[model samples]
Target: MKPLQTWVPVPENSDFTIYNLPFGIFSVAGDAPRAGIAIGDQIIDLAVLADAGLIAPEKDYFTQPTLNRFIGLGKKVTNEVRLQVQRLLIDEDSELKKNPRFLVPQSEATMHLPIKIGDYTDFYSSLEHATNVGKMFRDPENALLPNWKHIPVGYHGRASSVVVSGTPIHRPKGQVMPKGAASPVFKPTGRLDFELEMAFVVGRNSDLGESVPVSRAEEYIFGMVLFNDWSARDIQKWEYVPLGPFLGKSFASSMSPWIVTMEALEPFRVKGPDQDPEVLPYLRTEGPKNYDIDLSVGIRPQNGEEEVLCRSNFKYMYWNMAQQLAHHTINGCNICVGDVMASGTISGKDETSYGSMLELSWGGQKTIDLKNGATRTFIEDNDTITMRGSAKKGDVSIGFGEVSGKILPAK
Candidate 1:
């Protein structure tokens, strides 16, 4: 679809165009979470449209802290709502074109979490990230573990601790093993780090005894968001000997406030990395299932400026979204609306494509030179890690604004 000619200053082009009806909750006058759709530079308040009887049925699901209630209404209802809102916002034939007073300028509204997360699971599905990380601690033959290729590897994460973007993350305190030590020492995390990931929000619930097939997996996913699963590497290495990450990962996670629906991203969708040994039957997919979103990580020291640290793409993932969601329900585990399934650190072949400091510096054995004669291996206490994403075609760029957090001293 060609771009529409709207008076809102979306430039001659913008990502939040008429075609993209991304959803979010906002408050214009100190109200609770009310549905809104991004159109150019304006926000179409869904709750108000519903109340005015301008939009149909899903109106009752508005005015909540999260989008779970609205999302629970099913994808059929979701598609209809999205299409109707799209027409109302862009089509001149609709009543929205006649009444512009009810429209809230995007600049004045506040964005909240689009969904209420009940469960979160982070998956290790990046091939290069796995290879690079493995090469650091083991021989090339031993890089990928025996079970790495066969299944989707993941760990349950702390959900309550997840925060929206713009939050300040305190340096977490944990046990770190000092050099040549038979025992470990406890202290504030010294090696804070960032992971560039893409997270999907669950749209519907599935029963405990039923598995969501790969074919119908997209139906369960409402949308995608750029996610930063903050980490404390020093603490993680010491504590993850037996079980997986706890304090090292539980401290903080940041996500972009806007939930870009699957429909909007469909144009950029493509096939994922090929599975060599062939995925397990439960993890099989029959179509092109990944989106071509260019993602990156940028770091700015407290005293210094911003430098694009790494660049990568979501298409580098070895396991696609469908495979991840399918494997998640293999045990007949029930998944509810608002549950988050995240793609782990996305990295590519080049040094600039490395997603984490562990990969960039090869486990702190080398130093990364900065623009102003500074260098770093892991994040400093006051350093800020910002992650940005976009999918550009020709002159227009479909963007995921950014997810950023400053590292504060441990509390």
Candidate 2:
């Protein structure tokens, strides 16, 4: 199919094309945040469109600060709304082309967290990333734990600290055991890291005792976003022996403002890596469950040029989103509309494609030489980390914009 042509002039390089109408929350001046769709370099204000009687919902879902309420209306309503907006963009004689109030320049709009995430889960799904970390920390021969091939390993994460892109995160102070030391010392994290990832937003709610089947897992998903799961390696290393991460990861996680819908990414679906051991019946899924998205990570030193740290892809995951969601609710754990589930550290087979400093620096044994003449084993204060992702197949392209966070000195 040809890319949807619109009267609205789209820059060739812009991520928002007529075919990719990602949604978000944005505000201008002192106005309250409202739902909007990204197209080219402009944000089509859904609230304005709703007010103009272009696309109406039963409730004022478009005027809300988060997309959760609008999404809770179900995919049938939300998808129709997106299709209506798409039609308006392509129709040359439509009122949208003549109206200036319905559109806002993206530069002027303050993007907010698209969803009010009620709960967050970070999954260790990437095969290469899991293997690399296991080799580094665990025995080389026995990298994967026993249950890795059977289930999608994940930990419930702190949702309150999750922030939108451009939020600054302070280095976390926590206990770390020094080399040749008997006890751990509390200090600002010396080995700060960033995990390049993609996360899906849950759209539908489930009952407390009902389990969502693997085949129907996609029904619960709304869209995807670039997620940067910030980490303090030292703190995690010391505390993650019996239990998982706490202060190290709970400090902050950043998310892209725009949410590229699952429907938009349908064209880019591809087969995921084959599981060695067959998954349980509840976790079994068919079809191309994974998406072929290009992902990259970059770091910009304070007052320096941004250098690409690594290049990876989402298809490297050992477990797909369907399996993750299936396993998550298999035990009858209910999920809410704004719940977030992240694919942790999407690393590839090569060292250049490693997702975190822990892998690229070989557990701080080597320093990553930067283009700005600075070297890094771990993130330093004032250094900014940015993650970008996109899916393309011929003329159709979908983008997740970017999630960026600058590290600040610990208070």
Candidate 3:
């Protein structure tokens, strides 16, 4: 497909190209947060466009602070708006090009969480990530649990603690069991880590007791974002026995500001890893279920330069989003429009492809040498971790710009 030319001057390798119109919520110095779409280095204020009678004039969804209302309008309206915005951007003679008030420079705007998340679920979908963690903590021969191959394993996450990019996270203090110790001690996390993952936002709601089959699962998906599932290894190790993650995970999780629509990513879809021992009927999906998005993680020490730590891909996931959603609602569990579901810790076969510090450093048994002569087994105080993702084919590319967070001392 040929690149869509626009009247705006988008850089050659820009992530926000004409082919991509990712959405977010942004506010100027004194203005309230409103819906906006990224274009090159500028953000098109959707609220202003709506007020000017360009798109969705009769509806007030575009003027809202969160994309939840806009997304709730369903795919038909959202897709039409997207196509109209694309046409307005590319047409040189359009009136939108003459008005500069609706365009805001990205540097002058503060981005907020794009949606009001009603619930969040994180799925253990990557075979390599699950297998690596299992080998470290459990027997290598039985790395995967007996039920892992049959179902999409997931845990309910705290939606209230989910923050947007650039939010600072304090090290969580929790009980930790030391080596050969009879009792655990309460202290700040000694093993702080970040998980590289991607999440999809739900656009349509499902009623209780009504199951959404695999065939209709994609229709409910709104978009995708980069997710960082921060972890405290010691806290999780001590607490996770019968019930899954709690305080160790509930403290905080970060997501990228912009939500790249599934329509924008349709061109980059690819086949995911083959599932062995075959999944059940409900989890079965056809066509390219996974997107070929390249992911990377970087760490910057207090006063040091950023060093790229790991490289992974979304295609490595053993269970795709469709399967995850289908399994989620199969048991009559209801879902809301702004619900967020994540693909947990995407890792590959090699050491450099590991997503989290626990896997990359081999459960703190090894040290990762930094460029400034500093080494680390896990994240340190004042260190910033950034996660980035992009999907490209030929001349067109779209990205979920970096989701970064700095660690502060425990409060």
TM-score of each: 0.95, 0.99, 0.99
Off by over 4 Å in 3: 57-59
Evaluate model 3: give its TM-score: 0.99
TM-score of 1: 0.95
lDDT of 3: 0.92
User: What is the Cα-based lDDT of residue 101 in candidate 2?
Assistant: 94
lDDT agreement of model 2 with the native: 0.93
Sort by lDDT, best first. 2, 3, 1
Tens-place lDDT digits, model 1, residues 209-259: 999998888899998998999999989998897898898999889998888
lDDT (tens digit, per residue) of candidate 3 on 61-99: 766889998899899988878888899999999778999
Worst 10 residues of 1 by lDDT: 4-13
As for candidate 3, its clashing pairs are: none
Each candidate: RMSD to true structure? 1.8, 0.8, 0.9
RMSD of 3: 0.9
Query: Comparing candidate 1 with candidate 2, which one achieves the higher TM-score?
Result: 2
What are the runs in model 1 whose C-alpha is more than 4 Å off? 1-7, 394-397
